[model samples]
Target: MPSTPHRWITTPLTAGLVRGALDLEPTAQGILPHRLPAWARDQNTDGQLAMAESQPSGVRLVFRTRATAVELDTLPTKRIYVGAPPRPQGHYDLIVDGRPAGRAIATGGNTVTIDLGTGALEHGTGPVATLRFAGLSDEDKTVEIWLPHNETTELVALRTDAPVRPADASGRRTWLHHGSSISHGSDAASPTTTWPALAAARGGVELVNLGLAGSALLDPFVARTIRDTPADLISVKIGINLVNADLMRLRAFAPAVHGFLDTIREGHPTAPLLVVSPILCPIHEDTPGPTAFDFSRLGDGRLLFTAAGDPADGAEGRLTLNVIRDELERVVARRAANDPNLHHLDGRDLYGEADHRELPLPDRLHPDAATHRRMGERFAAHAFASEGGPFAEAEG
Candidate 1:
């Protein structure tokens, strides 16, 4: 008798297997997941937000199968900064049965070259890359393939030695989070290790990360998106992007924050809604932003940022970390009096001045991998692990 040939089954990458995205766009080559729905995407025109939402930070392909071998074809948008050393390749993290199993990277895909100094751009395309994982346990198990947190990826195809189906529901609460680059896994070791991801795992909750890089500017559309989304627990990390982008003055910031929270309350009237202020960033602690790249570091191929706005500008309502924090606390306090579920978490508690002394932010903006871990652990303790904490009831 002839030996049986190895068998492989290919499946369409549909919304059934994708999580953490609000919409799925069909492409000729594959499916592109977007954190923002088509309607919200249409309401926005900012290229930065569009790019950030396109990156599937906390999104993952989750399914149940006994396949000992699996492969994923992806077209990733890789970035190359002119005159700078290439950044490390983004990682795809694998988890089995709620635990980390393995990791891999897709090699070829699209590349975008950007010149920071002149603001020039160029693009190139490469063959879709296939990432594979072998020697998995043959036992029926839930498999989760986490997309790269920092790269925009399109799912081209999935192949496994055995057929796959939707994973059994874990019966975990869904945690919806929105924040800036730090929460977007800017310098995280991998997709699954981002602070929000880690916190969700430890809290035993499903995560929907809307950490839209530099785009968390308290947009009404974003607030509307959050309002429409369904979640057991919701958190919005504000302040960092507002300061760093110098998007609005204090007068405008307060109403924006209020309106954002009000919109969410409209849809989730009784959900445990947590408002988080910006973490301790010494560079912008007191100084107003419009953060500018410290191009001086470019000589050594290092990227760093510095505050561009004058400190004295605060008298004119220029927003800073401290200013934002005070306003957020006030807003939550007033609302919590009548709305019992409303809560606030100072981002400093997650990554504060003490943390900065030991593990300074390498880029002066985003936390590094270790800080990510620390923030995640601290956040879990305060939000989910602590007695009578915001999400503790759900956790219990």
Candidate 2:
């Protein structure tokens, strides 16, 4: 007889078992709802703890398996709950092993059942869904089980033989990064191309991405979220979003940063936390941002900025990368005496003087895929490497 197949069993446990199982927080603010296992809670606008409202709409479960042969089995009676407030009409893609396995449609109601194969699973809302797996080899693979627009639905329970634990059981190290849309991977060709993802790959460390597009306003909840998690390495890319949104003034920026770091220290007493400012953005490099424009096209196929000469052009202390960089250094320097683990990385160092000449960030805001690759390489060399280097000692 052939050898008996080896299998492990996974069942739902108290939320407590899931807590601290990973270094990252499962909750996210803004358009995306907080996604926690059945046992976790969501934070309110006032930063108070509340029952989690719904599931997340994007990638959630991600893990790598060492086993060459894998099998997934779930309870046959599982029922997907489509809660009240029907979601937008869209089809959901079921992806397994990073490839499409099948699709679930949400035409009217919210709930849909899917049959994902033995591989990983990913689901997304869509009209045209395609599941393709053409080049998968028989070996250990990283699995990403995704649910797009899942905030409108809930994954009541998941049963599988694949281990629920992280790939790095040894707990060698951790890297936590907080940034804007770029870090959140707005326009990357693929999920792994994001700078944070790329850097994590090169550094040989686990990554926790706290990137929120138009949402990294130095919120206390975010600081608390970072504080609550444990990490071996930490970095925060600030400025660009603040400038773009005109969220704060000079008077409010410094103290907010101090408080954010203070809160993080409360959780990670000695973990290295590097504060990074924005890279060169020609529009806001020297000029105050919060710039607005009205796109009006002439009879010809040409566009013009109607609000180019608006009165709000140069309000006092408006957002600017140069201004933020100066202030960020001052803030880090002031806190360094008491917090030895704190450091700063000027964003320009990652993509500055020389890079702009060759590969400018498309749209003057978010870096293109090439920029992400370049930035990831430089970040690994200077910060993530374990050997004695710029940030190695502080990281520990």
Judging by lDDT against the true structure, name the best candidate: 1
| Residue 184 miss distance in model 2 (angstroms) | 1.0
lDDT (tens digit, per residue) of candidate 2 on 1-396 = 112333434433323222122222332111222422223233335211221123222333444544333222111111232221222232234334545544433232223433222223233432212222223344555544433321233223333344544333255467777777666654454445567767776776666666665556787777777777667778898988787667788888899988988888888888878898887767777666564532333234322222122235445666577889999999999889888778888999988968888986555566777988888888888786667543564443
Cα TM-score of candidate 2 = 0.65
Candidate 2 deviant stretches above 4 angstroms: 1-168, 293-315, 386-396
Q: How does model 1 score by TM-score?
A: 0.97
Taking the tens digit of each residue's C-alpha lDDT, what string does model 1 give over 1-396?
111225778878888899998998998789999999999999998877988999999999999999998888899999888877677789999999988889998898999898988878899999899888889999999999999988889999898989999975567788999999999998999999999999999998999999999999999899999999989999999989988889999888888888999999999999999999999999999999999988678778788999999999999999999999999999899889999999999998999978999999997898999999999999998999667889986433
State the displacement of the C-alpha of residue 45, model 2, in Å, after optimal TM-score superposition.
Answer: 5.6
- Give all candidates' CA lDDT scores: 0.91, 0.55
CA RMSD of each candidate after superposition: 2.4, 9.9
| lDDT score of residue 140 within candidate 2 | 57
* Highest TM-score against the true fold, candidate: 1
Lowest lDDT 10-mer window, candidate 2? Answer: 72-81
